[model samples]
Target chain A: MKTSTLRPLGRRAGDLPVAMVFLLPAAVGFAVFYLWPTLRTMYLSFTEYSLLAPPEWIGVENYQKVFGDRLFWNSLQVTVEYVVINIGIQTVVALGMAVLMHRLTRSGLIRGVLLLPYLVANVVVALIWYTMLDAQLGIVNQALEWIGVDPVAFFGETSTAIPTIALVNVWRHVGYTALLIFAGLQAIPKTFYEAAQTDGASEIRMFWRITLPLLRPALALVLVLTIIGSFQIFDTVAVTTKGGPVNATRVIYYYIYEQAFQRFNFGYAAAVCVALFAILATLALMQLKLLRAGETDLD
Target chain B: MRRTTRLTAVATILSLALAGCGGGDDPAESGGGTAAAPTEISYWLWDSNQLPAYQACADAFHAANPAVTVKISQFGWADYWTGLTTNLVSGTAPDVFTNHLNYYPEFAGKQQIQPLDDFIAADGTRTDVYAPGLADLWVSADGKRYGLPKDFDTIAVFYNKKMLADAGVTEEQMKTLTWNPTDGGTYEDVIARLTVDENGKRGDEEGFDKSKVEVYGLGLDENNGAGVGQQMWSMYALSTGWQFTDKNPWGTSFKYDDPRFQETVAWWRGLIEKGYMPSLAIARSGTSVNDGFGAGRYALSTNGSWMINTYYGYDGVEVGTAPTPIGPSGKRATIYNGLADSIYAGSEHKDQAWQWVKYLASADCQKTVGDKAVVFPAIPEALTVAEQKFAAKGVDISAFTVQIHENTTSLYPITDHASDVSAVMSPAMDAVLSFEAEPSSLTKANEEVNALFQ
Candidate 1:
């Protein structure tokens, strides 16, 4: 028995080499690409570099400029407003669709129809919305005229532009979010619902107590993803307004792009990037804590 | 504990894999191998339609010089600037590229563009071969010439002949029309009368609703940059004895707060207020004002001669070109915007790049390109060929050529922060046009912009 145990231990030790061989390429890739760049960006943020000259050590100057910039503050406000509004609306709309689709017998057709918008590229969505929202010749305004409502410049006005963009963002992603929630709904066993029904619980109570409680994990995942996606919003704003009508819709990423590419101010842009990463990391950690709290309460 | 360790290892590997996929190959090291092989020169340009003509010119140069090879690349105008600037900063810019006068200063200040003085001296090419006061415009403040003159453009009035006929107006009537700050000459009155409603009512008629009008006599888009909008307004402002700067070339302060400037803005704005022009909302929708004119949605639209080819291609539209309407300052003025071919200072093959640039500025290449009516070549001798080409195309473009000869002014001096200044000016001007602010408020905008320049 001792000889057999020793031989099995030797074989287990040999398996470690194979496992490392499988992981070596990926490990090397991550070290060279993501980790190195993140560290490099962090170092660069403390310097003054314009890509033309060698970087000069100017600790905290770049960071100070970022904080002092009114544009940066405006962009951050816009980003947060976009994230909160987008996440709230998208989550509710997605959940409603998922729940509705879950109860349907013909779920395949409904799910396929819902997945269509998610498959369309963001630029295409922007173009479609631009055409539809055009003030004079657009179908939306034309239809509004028929109803005796004055033509509204959906993108031209500062007040309506950001929300309109947010609405479009929510419209594009709702279907995908709903699909994720639908899968979570399916994974929850039917036996729980049956038991709840036998307890003579109302439909509303069953939904609140049974369905929502089980969906906590999926909800947490979707919420985190939506927030992250909303934070990085660039393409739609670029294609639609170009952050115009007096910079009403300028978001953080576009601001970063304008600095780095337009002004060729790489060091300042890198500082902004670092700050963005820190903010994202903090939000992610908070999400993890909230998720853990939810899990403990559920238990 | 064993499961947690395995998960950590997996996550670490995944993150490492992501990290490895980041930063591109250094361009400097990649192109070194081919650098010595046959002196391959790269040419960067933006216009797709003009690429064929450029390619033909490149072929001519190659035939003349068998040792050197030219490679041409095309990008959209915006991408061209972004890519050129990015590469310039990275020290891997193209050997030669088209440079706009407006953007030349920014690159020149950064030492991104090479001074072509030595090349011009070596070739013994006379600067007088080009238009007067044109060739010297590209020289930096340090007295270093940076680029070769390629083409020149001036703004003019493009009108629909059929629309004029429908309104009982003749081409002769348009030729005599003049303008002032307070009164927009006979042109404004004609525009007011020609602008029609669904019930065949004009802007000047009683019971004619400005909001409900079906057609506009004039089309103007406020969304355009100074390259277009400011050029149009300058015609009025200059005629009203307003100067964009204290001097024609390089004065420091803008004269927008001047009474003449205010009158010019008010006159342009009154077109919208009187319903002679489309509302700011409608004019901005769909295509630009040029497109609106092509679609026959407006009787007249103001544009530069560079877009003549674009306008001529439209069906059922009888196009006529005229000089800008005379303003109260007793002058019909046009802003002359030109383009040039500049050599990259950082280029390894400076000799070959200069050779190509000199060839472009030569009369042979200019005649070949300009004779096709593609553009008005900067070489003065090529003007005859260009005019003939336009006449061959069944339109006399001489109106613009004549306007430039008599009333041309160089675009505002190449400020170091020119793009930034324009960035501020464009939106501020838009705000004024949108009726959200007054023209005088531009002083505040100018102050903010001047602060940025400082």
Candidate 2:
């Protein structure tokens, strides 16, 4: 009803200098930190550099090796497993909390309680969880023992290590994600829900039909961010697992770190990083497209 | 006029940002060629226990040469390597830093560290002053001296005296414990006898529940010390006459596949199966071996001499150290590794850095450092003083020193691609230790490690 003739907005010549003045710092920062490092990583992927010596260009040799690298494939698979577990659980839990907060209570105190875990540093969260979930000495195990359960090797087993790490990260990130969805929920006009209620629609039906469709953009953002964050998991694995119980939790970033810092194989590490970048970029595009992040049904 | 004012503000902001980028480049602080200009030499080390000792040396050095000042910086072990490597790449590494045998080869190979032979020869610095093999370990494959020996370490067994007494195992029994790959010998027996279950039954008892174990006799660290196993099973393997490689300080191929080594690993793994040792899961459960020992979970922990003070620091635990068990070769062996000081090749004050390095390796510094009783100095006299200081603290260090006195020490496995070798061997060794793979898997791992050299 509020439609108007649409036209592509163009930058005015008069505003260019003002915009540039505002954008200079950010542009400089992006160029120095992000763009330059990305370009350098791409270039280093083709060379054999050990940090100590100058890089030696070797064409596609490093990439070729990466193709046949079993470790790379394993890391990618492990990272995918972590992402699936992390994103699936984190999304559902966050959505539930968001809905609960949106419908029941919108208190800032409750939201702050939800966001508290996210406020803690990743390293601190990891270390505290590592202590709590320890197989022998942790309080979690002691509690489990009291309830007739055998002690679980949370971070030590091949099957449980990545899931344990995923769950730990989920605990840390769920609150922030819930807050994001809660914000989206706030943006959803209450009139739509009120109308649906008057038309004899159940709460679940209205949620499925109206709320989900409207929540696409926020979900898409959460997915893309979390998927990327989950893939680059190094701190938890570094402190807890160190890619062990026989490479069970050797995520891509940890592999890259080991190659670059530990082994001094900077070129190989860079090549792996490029491959990770490609995978993440492709996944992000697919997610955005599938979610239709740009188009909201609000109009 | 308004537009010009806005442009001026923008220019000011841009200039400030650009100025911030250039703040790291301070050539003036790097010192000058002329001795008349006061020179500041930056030194770095990883050990915090040795910080006060080195700081004292810095004070003395400053007193001796008023024009030259030594500034010391300390970082934690893991951060030290990360910072050092990053700084080396960025051409901002300290002028002189403590170097490890694990990294010195790689640094020397890349020519990132300055060869100290020229300075040593020019100053007639006595390389032979250090304990046997300490000074020699710094000589690279190209026969260039890259560092000056500072301190040395050896492996020994730190045991809980209360646990030993409760298990009825005497200190003499611990000292004379012998091990063989075929049966695990007296060492295994002692470990089994010491291991206690939740029901208070020893591992050797008929109904001792392995699943309900309260205390493991032998403690294991996370990995097999990245295949070197310096503080884990290296002594056991070395005592069996199984050298890590054909030659150390530069070995082209590793001999991890050797039957002697494989059997040593197998026998060590058997301790896990028999419940004498904690499984890899419990060991790597984020509780360190020393912490586990202090908590009464581990009766004995094989550790390095560097951790001597740490083991002693555990409260409410009567700690004592014993020599490693003699193996099939009838010799009790320990891996002898020493730390040294090396100058960065890109250092601005090479002359001052060399002078600082010289002073750090001298008797003046070594004696002061040894007097702290924190570590064993490389110099024999300083080491003797350290031993005396340690004795004054009621710590019997003969368990660590007997290897040096008897010449039953093997050098740390120094090879190129040390981390690459670790990458291949750590998982393989972990698999074997974790009971996920067989010891024969190490043969394949050894092949892979050797392939790196090829």
Candidate 3:
């Protein structure tokens, strides 16, 4: 009876015009802004476009060159390194904060304070951290000196640059990610924990068996958003390292930026962008499937 | 079937609506529409420091020519190029904009800039009015003039007067230091004596702590400087009689691997090894070298003449200038770079823009700019006036001016694929400076840079 009453509205001819009216504005926006530019980028990937002249179609020449480009591969590897460090720490810390928030105060003030760093602009955060991590004059180095520990060249050494950038970004994003998971925690019933307590199950066991399985949908969403966001890390790198101390922080997006803006190699840049798009799309889909984003333990 | 037809109609309507709203291009406003039509042309420059002088020129220009006016816009250094390039492609760039030697080659090759030969011929403008080689620097490989040189700069050593005195070094000694690639010569001696450790021991003294430096003798503004190293190493390498390319303006071959250049780089890096200069990591840790100099953390800094006001602006600091150290070639050198004005090819008011560019290159506008003492004007007479202005301010700027007088200036490397060259050389140079790779690695990087030309 429920399935009959909840029949898909698209199947009825009478409701079709109403649905079209609602979707028209959004469809127009999508076509003009998103879809058109994407199509153009895809087409430009196979052509030679320098913005000064009309695009000349070269038939996969750019893609062929990308295969041999050492810088492109370096950028990809550096970007992956940043992603692993950023996501690995950010997820676990965010999950822990979410649980703490759910079990404890649930205070809006604490939540607001947690979201403060995320509210600040990425460039601002990067610059502030950059100053605070200066090898000689930064406060962080000064503190380390006070404790008899040697100062680390946070963004200066090639070995430490990518990890430093990733950690700074993790600091900025963890708060927002925590809030997202906190909202997910609120949707789970308190009665489940109470019932588990009555069943003589430990709190940790209840969290593992009940909390995590139900939180899959939210976790999947956060992973997809943060992962996609992480892959597009350009502003922080651009502001701080500028992909230097020797291309150590030259992530893929920054490499694409250098090619397109610095070298004016638009076609090659487009090819790289297309490759990045494919990678991110594949990652997003894999996460959704592995986590069963739509299925709920409650059902 | 009916539902599908309705959906297709909705999609078509949305597509048409998007198409209708997308036409944002402006119609070309006709220039010289009517006699005395009051055509206002737009001009853009990157340096905010020079805005007041340029604005003064604009006011004078408007008074002289009632029918035309110039509106000036200033953007920060990096944003200026990004904005200019985007606007140039979109046909919305200013009528005229400041041009750099590094970028004008690409701009000229792409035909985004207008050739000024015909305009110069029609106006009978004197091309020889600017400093020697300055006018020629803006000519493209096709032998077309793209810009008119407006101002010039040369690098010099700016040092803290109190630090030099406290180190028992006289100003005369500072002015006449000599150097060699082998052991760094007296130049290294002065730097080492100037550097102080945490316990207040000088770098040249026994028991000096290289790890815990209180003050660096030399302040570095950038790491490897993307292979240009204008203020940092250019003076040293050029003093050794080394050039960046096979020839000036449009040289296809680079000489980054040349032993003379490599040895100069090695000596410069050796300062860091000996605790006289900041390490590559500390130098590039987001703090301006000038800040360190201002805070007494740096005793000496090499900078271009354009920063004279900036160094002087630091409170409670008595700054003094010195020519770069004489090298094995028995001569001191500074890199001579200049900025110019270029007209966009798509400008509707090309004639008016040419008038402005001509005026800017003329002694009239340059004299006004010179009197402000902001920059060394391209015109010889105006440059003299600028020197007098500096003299009136009690600042001895002869160290910079002497380069031109002695003909010891090397032109800033002007070549196509400059950005590509920098991209390859920057990391390679960084590796060498950071002690991760040897200086010989620059040879591979130079090959990569040359490969781009092919």
Best by DockQ: 2
lDDT of each: 0.75, 0.87, 0.86
- State the lDDT of candidate 1 residue by residue for A248-270, as single tens digits: 77789988887777666779889
- Worst ten in a row by lDDT for model 2 chain B: B26-35
Query: TM-score of candidate 2 restricted to chain B?
Result: 0.92
Please give, for every candidate in the order listed, the TM-score of chain B alone compared with the true chain B: 0.89, 0.92, 0.92
DockQ of 2: 0.33
Alpha-carbon deviation at A1 in model 1, angstroms? 23
What DockQ do you compute for every candidate structure? Answer: 0.20, 0.33, 0.32
For model 1 the local lDDT of residue A161 reads: 75
RMSD per candidate (Å) reads 8.9, 8.6, 9.4
Q: Per-residue lDDT for A144-178 in model 3, tens only?
A: 99999988878887889899999999999999999
Model 3 sits at a Cα RMSD from the real structure of 9.4
Estimate, for each residue in A1-299, the C-alpha lDDT of model 2 and write its tens digit: 33323422443556779999999999999999999999999999999999988999999999999999999999999999998999899999999999999989969999999999998767667777776676766678879999999888788877889999999999999999999889889889999999999999998998899999998887788778887887888888876789997889889999999999999999999999999899889999998999988888888
- Residue-wise C-alpha lDDT for candidate 2, range B302-410, written one tens digit per residue: 9999999978876677899999999899999999999999999988889889999999999889999999999999998988899999999989999999988888999
Q: How big is the positional error of residue A245 in model 3, measured in Å on the Cα after superposition?
A: 0.8
Docking class of 3: acceptable
- Tell me each candidate's TM-score: 0.88, 0.94, 0.93
